[model samples]
Target: MKKKIKFMLLVYTLFLLSACSLRKDIHSYQKIETECDEIVQYLSEDDTEGLKSMFCNMTRSSSEFDKQIQVAMDYFEGKVIEHDPFTLKNDGSSVENGKITRLYSSPHLTGIVTDVGKTYEIKFYSYIINTDDEDKVGISKLTIKTDNGNECIIGEYIR
Candidate 1:
């Protein structure tokens, strides 16, 4: 009987740890989704500064992130950006039973044209957030794809 109680206690302890951090995770997910929606809005209005802020929040303080945001700013200003009807998210920014402490953005899809009028699909390939509470951030590696199946990194930015 003592052995059974000890085993039950062990399981209970694990469950408590996982549940303690869960409510926070759920709130963070809501924020990410809300942010992505706001980004689409900024894209629609061609808001350059707003775009920069939105993208910057996802990246570390790197020059690479700065450059990509410029590209995004330029693209929105001149080239046409047609956002898809629905945003795409892999694994849905969620963890099982709540114990999730990670923050992530859903992969975003947008159609863009260069200044010279070349067209490409811009897809966010990276959205990394530090698991720790530190202020560090990471840029998501992004790829631009032409209809012909060729792809290249347009920019690595904190998105």
Candidate 2:
């Protein structure tokens, strides 16, 4: 009877550990999604400064700032008609341990050009990772394009 109780205790401990790990992953994914939403909001409002604040260190230089603003303004000239949160996709197995990984895909946004009476779809990709200090989330590899297949902006940095 004592042996059975010990075995059950061990199993319970393992289950609790797994649950904790799963919770952490879900939390991280939600955080990433929230960050992506903020990006969409900034772009939709043409808030260039707010959008630039999301970039990572490597790409957030004075020289690149104005250009970044231009690209966003040019791509999203009119008010945003629709915006969607980024969806996570499985990125396949990692080589190190064959662990299944997930990544954020390009979120979709649509805007109407009132001047031309044309609607445009904007798709942009962002990668989020935990910073070295583990206190902040870092964002990088921002690439934006229009429905016409024009690569309007590409950001290389993490913030």
Candidate 3:
């Protein structure tokens, strides 16, 4: 009877720990999703200052960053008509509780930056928050990978 009770207690503890972890993961994903949405909105509006705030300090000073933003704004402004919500892809390496946290680690969000004019692929990068608060997430990077396979890192806020 004593052994059975100990085993049950251990099982309960494991279950609680698993539940807490699951909640934390969900919260992190939600935070990233929200940040991505804001980024898209800023880009669509051609709000250069707003978009610049999301970039890391180092990136903001780069000449390439300014050029990239200008190109993106020219393509996206008054052209984007719809925003598709971001989704996670399973790389098949890490899986837990029928879900994979790896997918959430660096989720890529794509959207149509134009509808009638030339279309551009807008890629948003989601970074996991390293702070003590697990519920926080932020956009660490942005890119516009052209058809020539050339990619530009427009924004980076990873710290």
Candidate 4:
């Protein structure tokens, strides 16, 4: 009877641990989606500052960050009229003792935006997140483009 009880306890503990891991993964996916939503919101409003605030400290401090934002703003015409669901290109995490020590993800967002009477194809080709530094726990790389295939704004601040 004691052996059976011990076996049951072990099983229960294993179940709990697995559940916790699953919860963490769900949370990570949700966070990524939320960030994608924020990107769309800021872009639709043409809020440069708002967009800037979404990036990591490293990116925000870079001299080219402003230029990247300006380029995107200049290229991406108007409010987002429609967008395809954000695709989770890559997602990974390093967990130590049931806590996430590092996390990374790349989400791709594509949509259409209408400026006066014309619509343009807008694509946030890459939204990268690498949470290795606690102080800079935000987007490390971002790329935005319009229908013009050759023109793109890229912001890369990796640490």
Candidate 5:
């Protein structure tokens, strides 16, 4: 029947659309994971410029950005011996008009735990906003602390 054929076509079209969306989500997840890895590498190498490049323009331009980065570098010293990969905890995305308007994530576990002479825990919050006349992206918040103390040696929150 024509009705049956039309219904099948409709289902097929919906399936294809969902598949595309799923692929895009996976791609975004992979990208976030890669970013996490890059952050760890940058910290381990004490590559200030490389780490700065990862942040959004808004964050990079902040007056305290350099100072905050220096604090983190000072607190985390020596060669990093070990680190854990990103464990996604909370994540969300907003899509409008067939485009992603915003995306964010906070990993379940601390971003990284490294043994560089001392144990250090790093945590981060990251987001991306894509809209007309406003584009904010990359790691928006970061914290670095030694596991032996309660003090947060390095904290940077950029809006």
Candidate 6:
């Protein structure tokens, strides 16, 4: 009887652990989508301050900053970006490995002429919040398009 109780306790602990992990992962995934949408307002006005307001207080090192910026930079260059958020169609089993793997694809921007004598290619236009940081959520990396819809990875270095 003691052995059976121990086994049940172990199983209960494992179930709790997995449930917590899944909830965290799904919450993180939803955050990415929210960040994408919130960044849209900043992108429209080219407002870096607006972008900063959207972050939920996160921090990062310089190198990490560059990596996230690249994600945006690629989009600004007229590349379509698609994200694979753990949804698979061809698997025989329905359950995943309990670990969420992200797949990023495509570019989300197109080269377009916004007005006379001005064409724009998006540099990194989306603002992503660093969910793990407490003070860096408002931070955003960026680049911009030149008159001919060409991208310049200048970032908020200027604006």
Question: Using alpha carbons, what is the TM-score of model 5?
Answer: 0.78
How does each model score on TM-score? 0.49, 0.65, 0.66, 0.78, 0.78, 0.40
Model 2, residue 138: displacement in angstroms? 3.1
lDDT of each: 0.53, 0.55, 0.59, 0.69, 0.70, 0.41
TM-score-based ranking, best first? 5, 4, 3, 2, 1, 6
Estimate, for each residue in 32-138, the C-alpha lDDT of model 6 and write its tens digit: 44554444445544454555454333323344544444444343432223322222121111124643333221123334333233445332322222223334333
Clashes of each: 2, 3, 1, 0, 1, 15
- The lDDT leader among the candidates is 5
Worst-scoring 10-residue span by lDDT in model 1: 130-139
Instruction: Give the candidate order by descending lDDT.
Output: 5, 4, 3, 2, 1, 6
RMSD of each: 6.9, 5.7, 6.4, 3.5, 2.9, 10.6
Candidate 6 — which residues are off by over 4 angstroms?
45-49, 55-134, 143-159
Error of 4 at 152 (Å): 2.0
Give the Å error, residue 113, model 2: 11
Q: Name the TM-score of candidate 6.
A: 0.40
- In terms of lDDT, the poorest run of 10 residues in model 3 is 129-138
Tens digit per residue, CA lDDT, model 5, 14-124 = 999999889978887887878777777888899988888777666777788889888877777776667666677677888888888777776532524455456666667
Cα error, residue 97 of model 6, in Å, equals 26
